[model samples]
Target: MDIFELDSAFVLHTYARRKIAFERGENATLFDQNGDDYIDFASGIGVNSVGHGNGRLAAAIADQASKIIHSSNLYTIAIQARLAERVVRLSGLDARVFFANSGAEANEGAIKLARKYGQNSGRFEIITLRNSFHGRTIATLKATGQEKFHARFGPFPDGFVYAADTEDVLRKIGGRTAAAMVELVQGEGGVLPLDEEAVRNLAAELKKRDILLIADEVQTGVFRSGEFTASIGYSIEPDIFTLAKGLGGGVPIGAVVTTKKELFEYGDHASTFGGNFLSARAAYTVLEILEEIKNSGKLARTIGYFARKNGEISAKYPRLFLGEAGVGLMRALIAKDDLIQQAVLERAHKERVLVLRSGGSRVRMLPPLTISKEEIDLGFQRLDSACRAADF
Candidate 1:
């Protein structure tokens, strides 16, 4: 009879969730059915870049739905082509794109691209960063660097190896190495940023050895890091990059963008729902808003400034805020203990501030890029109060 009771009956509990149900959201705030407002920091796990019910996004989606929602990939979609052009133009990486339904699907396409490129080369292995998070699919789960995800999912798609640095990476790659996949920020790995030096060396080495370097930009793309993609912050150019999360501006879409030379000739890969007209319109809307945000520089600077501000917060309360790490809008505050994490999350929820847990002991914050400085201040104040009142 109750909403939570209905959810409990139908939903399998794969995630350790907070006990709250949001009825609707606007900008960076969510309201429960009872009319309590919560300052949103998770932003649906970084999917809502332009924030809830963005006028432009809603209009674009509505316009496209009125005209056409989807057509088979066999017929060229004009909007999809336009979105692809914009993606290539902004990336400046001279890449083509293939759309997919979600982040995991984009990654699946990337893995397939690597395997296809490895054909007849006696190399079929992909090297991933240790503690890296890719996706939840079988191929991606196998390719994921974290061993925990492999639990009960195996006998997975073979030929995935995890290594930490250039040395270990080199050791892992042999005659069977096809691609070296990495994330600039390990979003699920406690927001750990990859070593830039290691990435540079690894990219160069992988390039020299003719191995494709795939950057998983799912959680770190579309100005979340004060730029187009977090990969830009590292200055490491990947051969193939998978993008999702923020790309659609809160719509369901994914893209695998890659170099002109890296794409398949014909029959290489495809997705039926990939570049449909509606999602393409959504992507275009997102990019347009991002351009405005970039031009303003206020939101960009504020997104970048939070790291330093949180760094100060970390110093002020070292016992509670162990530290802060991440780039741009995608950030995580290191909690001193798991109990603090749970307590802060619970209290924040009760106080109407939404947060998330990552890698066991971090409070993940993914406020929309459109979030205002005032909103950030308010949210952080609530979070601070929640932390202080939490039974740690």
Candidate 2:
């Protein structure tokens, strides 16, 4: 049986699998079994920040694995300690770190921390935005605002309330509210960025009530938005934030950073594979690469160039494209219609460019930060071809 046949026979039908299967990848491109190269604009949904097959990352992982891996949290691991220090320093927050294996787990940890912190105050409810996407776990699913993710997954855990406006948020924050979690840039909800002033105002209000502010930066963290974290650009300092997608470049890793260490007791949370040596090495290497990118000013230049090209594309294809949303490399091209968006994405894939969709109608592009200007131009050309092909 071929790859598709094998997948059909054994794999669970959870995801709508794409037609192509990638075999290998290297620096902003992936090769299929047929040896066709496709420019990766999705970047594994914003996980491959350091690009594919990075030699430095691979060497670091190999070196750490050779020495030791999978040391439990019961013992002190050198690499874990080092990585945590680096994270705390770069975050510009005096916080302790708890590692997990994915974004959902990180959010879960943050939720637990918030509830524990509010335990004495009789507060357990978490207020989230109406269109925000949190995670897939039972608790995180409850924390998510969209009803589509809640289908057939009931009964969900209690204490999750969706608020649309500031008044609604304030109304929901009576005695039971423990925290208010938000995604500064709602990646899955049509690449919508929250209004900075509104977020700050809400944060200040929540603070007066002693409500914790949890920023879900799962998709927007790790310099994906040309900053280490999107919260920094927004000028809102959340009490806690969850990170995962781009932290380990391609390796599975997640983290919850909080300003207060007293929020979580020792036995409150833990993860077996969270900060193992191999993953830690990969994450540390990613941070190092990001530092280099910052110092060389490549990240800033690339982001600026992409932003200009995005504007040009929007202007060039006025009929098909409505406009652009989002910040830095994490951007989206809003289509005039959902059908046009889907058609454009399909056509782009056929033209050897891989892009993504957000909220059904926005063409999401999260190319690796290390992507070259030439590669960005190529991607834009392919997208342009797609727009022309799918023109009504």
Q: Which ten residues in a row have the lowest lDDT in candidate 1?
A: 308-317
lDDT of each: 0.84, 0.89
**Residue 91 alpha-carbon offset, candidate 2, angstroms:** 0.9
User: Once superposed on the true structure, which residue ranges of model 1 sit more than 4 Å away at CA?
Assistant: 260-262
Structural similarity to truth (TM-score) of each candidate: 0.96, 0.98
| TM-score of candidate 1 relative to the true fold | 0.96
Cα RMSD for predicted model 1: 1.6
Q: Candidate 2, residues 194-274: lDDT per residue as tens digits?
A: 888888899889888899999999999999878889988988888999999999998999999999788788688988899
Error of 2 at 27 (Å): 0.7
Give candidates' CA RMSD values in order. 1.6, 1.1
Tens digits of per-residue lDDT for model 1 on 257-305? 9884545777878788898998889998999998888888866687766
Candidate 2 global TM-score: 0.98
Candidate 2: C-alpha lDDT: 0.89
